[model samples]
Target chain A: MLLQAHSPRGLGSLLLMCALGLYLALVASISLGPMDISFSDSMRALLPKQSFLPSELAPHIEVIIRQVRLPRTLLAIAIGAILALCGTVMQSLFRNPLADPGIIGVSAGASLGAALSIVLFGSLAQHYPEVLLFATVPVCAFIGGALTTVLVYRLGSGPNGTSVTMMLLAGVALSALAGAGLGLLNYYADDQALRDLSLWTMGSLAGASWPGLALAYASLLVLGVLFYRHAKSLNALLLGEAEARHLGVNVQSLKRFCILLTAAGVGICVALSGMIGFVGLIVPHLGRMLCGPNHQRLLPLAALLGALLLLLADMGARTLIAPLDMPVGIVTAILGAPFFIVLLIKQRGRIS
Target chain B: MSIAIQTHQLSVSIGSKQLLKPTSVALQSGQLTVLLGPNGAGKSTLLKAMIGELRASGKVEVFGQTQKSWRSERLARHLAVLPQSSELTFPFSVREVVELGALPLSVSKLQLDDIVDKNLALTDVSHLQLRPYPMLSGGEKQRVHFARVLTQLAQAGEQAILLLDEPTSALDLAHQHNTLKLAKLQAEQGACVVAVIHDLNLAAQYADRILLLERGNLVADGSPWEVLSERRIEAVYGYPITVMPHPRADYPLLVSA
Candidate 1:
């Protein structure tokens, strides 16, 4: 029965199906927008025209597709994937399903940095355009996210190294500190700066650009691949530190590697999308439900499902309210919160 | 293949508290060597030192090589340890848990499956293979952990060194015997087995030699008859114990004095 459950063909088929679904979802996402480009026109827009291209399918449409919407959609996918990957790594690192990138203050720290950029560096906004202004936010956010993670790790690690409980506590403390900093920034901001900071905190894909998408997606994919390769080692870690060491895993080194990878992944996602909540928490849980807990299967499945969910959420954010544009984070919270509650209720007996 | 595990003047101090005093002991190859002691006797500490899990003042040599000289993966390939408590955070299946034993072998999937199956059968946990490991009773979990250690031993072949710290604490009487019987069999097959046991009767039944520890010091080492004497058991455990000849074997059975 165990053999049947772990059949390579079965896993391969499931992965293939998920990959096909993601591809279909990506194409469908590209078909969606404020402009009503039909599926045929969208396909034609992607390729060279048989006849002379119409002015409607002009260079501007190409720019919108290639530069604007494509990057934004890709950012959604990358951010979603990175967030979910971080969730998986964090949960295993802490050995608790309750752990997520946000739990460790990475997102909150990044948000604080972005908030500070908006509030104190608001003058840069007039000097530079929207793209340049937004660029500074991610850079600052990355520094804040990475620094907070290092602090949490340092505080958590003992003489032997970090205990799971210590790490969890450190994360909570760091998150609270970040939240306090964010509150201070919010209180002192001018009206326009306050509005901009609020929007950034609420989270959106509107600021997604080619450079931003490139930075987010590239880091996420590389780290995600590295994580996927360490799936077996992660499984060894589930046995706890001593047993993992007995199994030839360098437990301390693996913990450090996981922390660095999770920090990078979470940092990039928060930088790109401005703290989209629940994707990191929910998607990995969903993956665990479907794939069981062998990370070899869980990591990739979680990445795909995460990307799909966020893409769908982004679509709803745009289409549900039309031109008004609800925040993508708000959309995810609305959809994800109830589902998370149900998961909690169902697993309440087992969870500590 | 002879397996000698020798701790040379080993000492462990944790934060100004001496957990294990400087002590030297040798466990001969192909013998069921039992470490007997009271609570806080540093039996577990000494075991950890032997496995290189804890940093110590002196050296542990596996066969003739210093433990530090052996790469961790290479050391794991030959040595298997069952810690006193294994707290699993994730709900891995019994099979997944057992498969970890073959990690040092870097076995192919087919070989890993075979090793897991055989070890599970040996530990009598084949029936529990599909069950969630964390959901099992303490005794059942201990059996599964034993299966994992056994799998590691089987993979390590003749050179395997099995180090178990109170492995039967959670088992029922029958299981306790069965588990020790499996250990004895492994030792007979030329693996060096060192087990920390509190039950003197079970130790008497299975062990080829016994080493008694008292307050982080080695107090006695000999055959069960030599170590399970009324005076020594009473002296170390601070309890009256009667040592009498077993009806079925040459070794002595220990009872309340």
Candidate 2:
């Protein structure tokens, strides 16, 4: 009988705390990199027009903050938000707390797509940088993600309505098939292409650019609004699919829309950052612990919490080994895996 | 008054097995209809078919409109169903879970609050509204779902169809009686309420009409006294039961003898 009320004030306070946490992480992310720009100077660099100050950071420090760290930070925010939102949606769609983006096979499909593109165009690897990644790779990944989703969806749905169990089993099978595809690609790839593919698989913000950042934000904005609008329907779905339909939700369309939307979101995320995991899987759960599992409150909170966690993880990636960047995925797995295990231990009673 | 739901030769089959045979029936508003049958007697299947949860042959109509003609949201406002079990495992509170039922309606925040609270009270879950749903006992969880369906139908204003499957399978004696009384009350308010229940005594006590099914066929349809005859109950259920008049109540009583 905890917090028997849905008080706006309680939600307002949680949002405030999350916002504060995000701000701190953002500042640390921008200012505490290898160069270690002063907080005030970094703040000034963040300003639209930087004027000379007595204690200004180095001339190139401005470029580092404005061009490099800023875009990477914002990209982290966008990708993290998208991943978390997609994760929450996947869990809701499956009606299970444990389901994540990978459960749908879209992430695997995207990885395969990236590897394929890298191998297909490896001959021009030395000369082709921007077109290879930003254009061809992302498009291929999106197409691949879309194809695999449609395949899984078709395999699961029938006149009896879409079967969650069937979809899950199909996803597992498809993920295994995609893994085999990746293994084959690895065998065939050239050395430079292999390196690129490996880097893509690890997931990073080192390749963050303005256009990609814009694309990520656009996906986040549209996906956020769409997911939030169906918050009530998603809550109804939690009861069970049959119960959901009785509550006026077109359960079939809801599932289809959710699968495709999340696929697009995950595809974009994989395109930009490769294989960032755990943010989506863990942040919604943390949000549910803060607020109840009402998607109205859960989705936005997940987005914010996702952004903050990824920002912190990305910061660790940048600074953990000095100038040599570790994959953001590694830090997330290291951080999230243990925290998730601890959470499971605490929730063992409820889980059982 | 008027027929609220009607099905014409509705049958369901999966592969070669008929889950529900060609069965025709009609249910009216202001009546509590109880479906009685043994295990795999197709009581649940008929309910699922009427609610459009299963792929059924033949035609079903609700409030004079073909079942397929109504949009999902429109039908939801006029119909609500409680399944045998829930797959919900999220950390939602009882109140939050009940609030999910009002998703189909465009009621004001004030009205929604009023509806949710009143249903919670009606279903005897008011005391547990703040409790986390997963922590509740099985009976308590069923009561919570009962309250949710009530909340869903709160704005339906009487001309609604509410189907409940094994609604009291988990409840104790007193709560079981209370739930049936609530279903009867909904029928009194002009809603067409149908329940798939295993207890013959409860069905005789609360239902205005009784439907008996066996092997996916409608075997009997009448008032409790007409349908609860000893020969029919023994034949359909393959068990010995004595039918007798209740000492004081007007309905027939059945005791497994």
Candidate 3:
């Protein structure tokens, strides 16, 4: 028996430990980079002007910490949390351990939407206002994510309930379709739009702006509260659909709520930071291992762990090659693909 | 006794083939009911329809209230069902799984813990409370779910309705009897308890009432002695069988002849 925690106190302590770890990672993320600023120097730059600490850091260093790294770090935290939160929700909904937004075509559909927005909107860029240009991609991406989720859900569910086999196959098919759509969009995109699309495919925090950061944080807040409240319902769902309904979980509405919010969450993440893969698939599994499968504890722990994992991945993407700046998506895939393979092997029974 | 479940012409059909022909029955509190039938005999279908899981046309009322009128959460307090098998692959501890039953109830934490503890003890799974659900034997997992449903019905008091679908199909011999004994005990406490059981002797011993079905129709409804007559059993099961008084007890004992 892997006796993880014997008491609520123990679990609370474990959550605290993960939070502490996340804090350290956040500090490290803001401190260490290609510019090579000291931890204390970055912290001083972040501290208020009224603080007693003397201002000895260079203006450029302060600018680097405040303008570049701080926004980037914040973006990573929000993106990672939303990704992990959405992943946990999708896995519970599908009842498949391996379901992740990136692996299951939700991210790909959102990417397709983003591509269409760029290519179509680019042609009339001069006519449209800057605000509309900024809003179109995320709105379109959200619609795309929601539509794909509904289509996959319809294909997978029947009178008996959800067929994991059908759901996964549908995901695979949608991913391929989305890929083809992207290829077509690439053919029509202008030079600037094409460059943006290619960078998005790679996934970087290089374009982290203030407005994007606000949107990401707002989504994290909304999704975090909404998802947390339904922790009990999600747990009942794991028992089976009828079992959940028996537990008073109005199963239909719960499924709809989960599908829509998770899609929107994924849409927001994909909009803010291009497809950061595997955080959702990996974080919940780790959370369950650490805290067992109680979503009440798992959701919060997953959010913290997700933020930590992505921040760490982003840190690696920046420093490993130093100045060359590897795409964070590539770094995450390198870390995630092996873990996914191990999970696949572990689930020796029906792959569905 | 009060009627705990009453169905009026409740029927279920697939695209073309009817799985359960229209049937009506009223089950009372203070009686342990067993739905018995052979393969494709609609025993499972009747149970599914009663719980509103299957799309069946007919009026099903519980505690004098129509199924459609009672809110799901409100109904949950009064009714809980144990599925034949759960598809839960998540690594939840046994206690956590049982605790999921109390989701719809507004009981205090102490009351919730008390309910879980009592049911875990009732199902004889108190020792396995900390064990992960997936690592357990199939029977153990079933008992854990049984405990969960029991916990949900705890606060329902006299209005509780418990439905078990082949709950002992996975249990050992000792556990099979133990599970029926628990269901009987629940019936004695005034809850309406129904179980789909295949073991004829076990049903004869524990069930206060028996419902025999064949090909989507109710073939027999009465005491086990009336429902499990040797000729009736032979005709339905397509096997020659003898029904004799048990050497140790007064109820019928079935033997293949």
Cα lDDT listed for each candidate: 0.79, 0.85, 0.88
Candidate 3 residues A1-352, lDDT tens each?
5542234456788889988988999988999899978888899899877547667788999899989999999999989999999999999998778888888789889888877887898779999886787788888888888888898888888877678678778999998999899889888989998988886676787778899999999999999999999999999998888899999999989999999999999888877787788899999988887887788888998999999899999999999999888889998899999999999888868564
Maximum-DockQ candidate: 3
What TM-score does candidate 1 get on C-alpha atoms?
Answer: 0.91
> Tens digits of per-residue lDDT for model 2 on B1-257?
89999999999999999989998899999999999999999999999999787899999999999999999898898899987778787879898988888888889999999999899988888998877888788888888988888888877875788898998898899989988899888899999999999999999999999999999889999999999999999999899999999999999989987
Candidate 3 lDDT for residue A231: 93
The most accurate candidate by TM-score is 3
Model 2, position A109: C-alpha lDDT score:
90
- Point out where model 1 deviates above 4 Å: A1-9, A49-67, A117-139, A150-172, A187-196, A342-352, B1-3
DockQ class, candidate 2: medium
Clashes of 3: 0
**What is candidate 2's CA lDDT for residue A253?**
95
Candidate that scores best on lDDT: 3
As for lDDT, the candidate ahead, 2 or 3, is 3
Q: Which DockQ value does candidate 1 get?
A: 0.46
**Candidate 3 residues B144-188, lDDT tens each?**
888999999877977989999998898899888888888898899
Task: List candidate 3 segments past 4 Å from native.
Answer: A1-9, A48-58, A158-161, A350-352
Segments of candidate 2 deviating more than 4 angstroms: A1-9, A49-57, A103-105, A121-133, A146-177, A190-192, A340-352
C-alpha lDDT of candidate 1 relative to the true structure: 0.79
